[model samples]
Target: MVSWYDPLVLAQTGVRSIISATIGSQADRRLLDALAAPKVEPSDFSVDAAGRPREELWLDYVADMGDGWDSTYTIAQTVSRPTLTLKDETGTTHETRGGEVLVFGGDEVYPTASVGEYEERTVKPWTAAMRGQRPAPHLFAIPGNHDWYDGLVSFMRLFCQGRHPAGWETHQRRSYFAVKLPHGWWLIGTDMQLESDLDEPQVHYFQEIAKRMREEDRIILCLAEPAWLVAQVRAPKERSYLNNNLDFLEEQVFGKKVSVFLTGDIHHYRRHANAEGRQKIIAGGGGAFLHPTHVPRKESELAEGFTQRKTFPAAEESRRLCWRTLGFVGHNPKFGVLTGLLYLLLSWMQVADLREGGTVTWNLGRVLGAALVNPGVILLSALLVLGLIGFADARFGRGRWVAGVLHGCAHLAGALLAFWAAFAISGAVLPLGSVPQQLLGAVLVFAVGFLLGPTLMGLYLLLSLNGFGAHPNEAFSALAIPDWKNFLRLRIDKDGRLWLYPIGIRRVPRAWKPGETAREPEWVADDKDATPPELIEPPIVIGLLHPH
Candidate 1:
């Protein structure tokens, strides 16, 4: 059974383990320094008397991947939270308990390889709650696109161990590594750097590992970004080298049968059956921003034995529209004045209709049809976004929108489109007379207006609301609940890979006091759905150790 844990905690532990390994006998000394190191500490937060946090951070989901992290590893952790179960082809169901050995998919930090960045953004918040947790599971990690943002200096210093003299430059002992588990299970991890010709050593190294796996019953291949998933969405040239149909190498080079392939990167959750009918899962939903939502496509659905869960049953609110501030068109006289163009685009159908026709033509029937025909595209784009949002929110608290104008717009659009499609099809059965033609046009207009009207209204409201305050003034208020008892819950999209809602994670608990808002233990399936240990901020790394 594959058990997933919090990504941030996994990254923190990986950094801790690597540093501990690198410092060797001085591991204790280095740890002492890390604990005592003086640094800027982000403020501790709590909900107001009404059960809402005074401050909440806005996080952007990762989309533009870079060279990627050095390595990705998947392990299990044993926490008091709960357990989830996954059944193999043999009808053997394995339960995944919380707080198991953590897995690392890659790009634990962002923009730079600075230890401070990782510690501040990921570690500090994570370790705060697990302070005295015992028997922390072993850690494994892989490189992601962003980890290479600063030449991977921060990653190497924080996570590498058992290295060669040439250091990480050599392929044989780079980021890719393995761990033999108690069962016949073998944990195989890899680095996404292979796309930039960073896998020569890893490829060779894995060949030997795969050969050894020939004798195992199942192999858990770890990846920062799901390599197969990328192959499904990316152009052939844009595909990562790590995904060079390496599974084919199993029979040819390793003389073994590969069972499961694992990956992360998009900060979501996904599980599928590979070409060989083996299981492939994407479990990146550790402590990161929830990804956007998407519908599944056809090729992905058509793949032999392919099954995806796009929407969760519980998160009906997700069916609403999400308002994203695209860009601010300021008056820059130095450049060609473009603010005037915004008004023109909104008013003129010829200019905006085709450009945004994708949305205009975005009928649910059409989208689902497209998904049935081309699941690959859907898998690449929307599924990633939807899975990320659904799973992340299930574990952590952050995403929730007001059921207002935005939702009204989405609902209106979907309804109108359904009516339009139904009526338009009636023309074939009924006579194609004046009545049919007029009805078609009317349906089309209704659909258009239903979708666009609320969107336009929402824009107007935002504009008005923003104008209500002066520059540097904020209009949006915190929506946090002061008590854990008041916490809202959400689910994943149905018809996607997971094909379940709330994706098996438990409901978020409400806060204790009216003015005190904090997350209770997650409702994992095990431990009778016990409470999470404690509430603390994540860790932050402040320094780096260069080449050994």
Candidate 2:
């Protein structure tokens, strides 16, 4: 229900982003350490039905959720099911039960993190899905950047406490956690607050965890951001810090034991593997807006020794979706209203009366000249250009400024042209009254501006993304497509093999009706055309690759 294109949402998020960068930078990490809770021991999660250490585990991973209700609930419904039977790409049927442990990788709430947003967007849907389940899964989460906007006070209170958000039990004491899986496997979730380096306390916590690991132990490291993919897209100087932090943790604390890296910041599903069989995956498509997988291109190598193995919504399909940006005004009508108002303001400021031979006419030249001399108009124009520049992603480096300036100019040019066309039309058809001509021109400019403004922006975003690999986040967030949601289900069997099942929801339900019973989900998909979850690919099995 929340559109990223909404002007209010954009404004609020912009302010939060600024505050988090300035004030939060100095205090958040230190506060995290100061309030660090008692760490959860691996033994707490390793127990089996017999109350002894187990040799196998089943867990579910989802992230970047807590957005629109329909999309978020659709994912929650599928994951909360007692069991799911899905056919892989080869038409072979595979059955998987709901995970015993549910891990939310990052960005549990979108736009901004707050108790109300978390309750409505996350808790309401998840709890509805598990209304009367007998044995509920345990919940764990790592804070993403959005969660850190409020210095993680809300996130920690909602998730770190041992409260049950749904039927699921919360057990993690800190923002970061370590869980001992069966068969010498460990699942570690790290909170890299706002892309900063790992806090000292976190490093020490993982160091203590390392002391308990056996030589043959393997780790499934959960990160808030996919630093590997980030390193590929960012400038050279900006790339190394996050990657270096992970490298240090791997080499020193964990002794190079991480066999799989799991993250969800990018909002899609992608798998990459190294020659050594270390797997890196991005499965952030829990419920947030879909992010295109075609970016950074298929040929751009992500990390050293790593090659991309698979991507959901194939690169070609992703490219095709970029074309949908042409429907920006249709998709985001309220945003169009904002653009329309801006155009009206500009048009009103430039309106000039020209009288010759007892006839009044609206002239494009006079209107433009008047606008140039107006101080308010100039200030507004400058702000518009600067705002667009600021909107550019820093990852684009210097090209961002160029893209911003050009994009702003295009909007300005389009507006002027709309004004010219409106003035000419009114002058040709209407009588020579100055007030009537100006009024009609203003209305026409607003109508045309609303349509043309966002349309121009959409075209700019589409061209930038497909042409230069820029604005990957901005381009797609504008569309807010609710489809192609995905999550991961993993099983570490008694034999110590890790089985990964990447589940995809091609289309989320758009309508919902009340459930028939108390045990059923409070809301069920009302549309008979709802699509069932499917396997993205064949089940991926990782055999023991670490040296004994």
Evaluate model 2: give its lDDT.
0.84
Predicted model with the maximum TM-score:
2
Best candidate per lDDT, number?
2
Count: clashes, candidate 1:
91
Model 1 lDDT vs. the true structure?
0.35
Off by over 4 Å in 1: 1-100, 162-173, 194-198, 240-256, 274-277, 299-304, 309-548
Q: What is the TM-score of each candidate against the true structure?
A: 0.44, 0.94
lDDT of 1 by residue, 1-548 (tens): 00012234335545654553444333222233223332212112123347554332110111111211100000111122244344433445443334233445676654334667666544443333333333233344566655654445566655554332111121112455665432234556666452333333445555665555435334556656655545554445655454454544455544444455555564444455534445555544343322322322333533346455332111222112112211111111211122122212222222122124333333445534443344443343344334333322111122212223333334334433443454345444655334664356444454444334334333433342332211110111001101111000111111111111112222222222121223331111133333332211111111111100
How many clashing residue pairs appear in each of the predictions shown?
A: 91, 0
lDDT of 2 by residue, 137-178 (tens): 888899999998877878888887777777678878788888
Q: Looking at model 2, report the run of 10 residues with the lowest lDDT sum.
A: 34-43
